[model samples]
Target: MSSFKREFTKLYNDSPANYIKAKRLEKAAELLQASDNRITDIALDCGFNDLANFTKSFRDKYNVTPSNYRLKSR
Candidate 1:
C-alpha cells in the first residue's frame, strides 16, 4: 500500500486523498458555475457529507465561497 501510494503520488504529483479531494472540489466548482443547484446539494453531490467542511475546503481552494463563486461566474 505504501509503495502504491508513493508511485501514485509520483505519477500524479499529489497524494491519493488530496487528488480525490481536489477532484471533488473541481466538480463542485463546475456545478457552482454551471448549475443553479443549492450549495448544500452541490456539496453532497460532490461527495462531501458535511456542508461546513465543504464550504471551508471550497474557500481554501478557490478563495471564495460557493455562493459567491456562483454569483461571480454568472
Candidate 2:
C-alpha cells in the first residue's frame, strides 16, 4: 500500500466507528448528487432510516443540508 492507504488504514483501524461513519457519509453524498431525490429518500438510501438523524449527521459533517450541498455542487 502507498503512504496514503497505509495512513488511512491505520486511522480506520484506530476507530472502526469512524470508518462506518465515513462510509455512511460517502453514500449519503452520492445519493445527494441526484437532484431528483428528496433528502429523506437519500437518507434512507444511505442506510439511515431516521431522517432527523441523517440530517444532523450530514450537517455536522458538511456544515449544510444535503439539498444545499447538491445545489452548491451543481
Candidate 3:
C-alpha cells in the first residue's frame, strides 16, 4: 500500500485520498452547475456520507459553500 501510495503521489503530485476527494468534489461542482438536484443529494451522489463533512470539504476546495457556489454559477 505504501509503495502504491508513493507511486501515485509521484505521478499525480497528491496523495491517493486527496486525489479521489478532489475528483469527487469536482464532480459535485459539475453536478451543481449542470443539474437542479438538492445539495444533500449531490453530496451523497459524490460519495460523501455526511453533509457537514461534504460542506467543509467543498468549501475548503472552492472557497465557498456548495449552495453559494451553485448560486454564483447561475
Clashing pairs in 1: none
Indicate which candidate wins on lDDT: 3
| lDDT, candidate 1, 1-74, per-residue tens | 69999999999999999999999999999999888889999999999999999999999999999999999999
Give the per-residue lDDT digits (tens) of candidate 2, residues 1-74.
Answer: 67766787787674555677778988889777755788888788778889889888999999998888999878
Give candidate 2's error at residue 70 in angstroms. Answer: 1.3
Pick by TM-score: 2 or 3, better one: 3
Alpha-carbon local distance difference test for all models: 0.95, 0.81, 0.98
How should the candidates be ordered by TM-score, best one leading?
3, 1, 2
Q: lDDT (0-100) at residue 74 of candidate 2?
A: 80
- lDDT (tens digit, per residue) of candidate 3 on 16-72: 999999999999999999999999999999999999999999999999999999999
Stretches of candidate 1 above 4 Å error? none
Q: Alpha carbon lDDT of residue 69, candidate 1?
A: 91
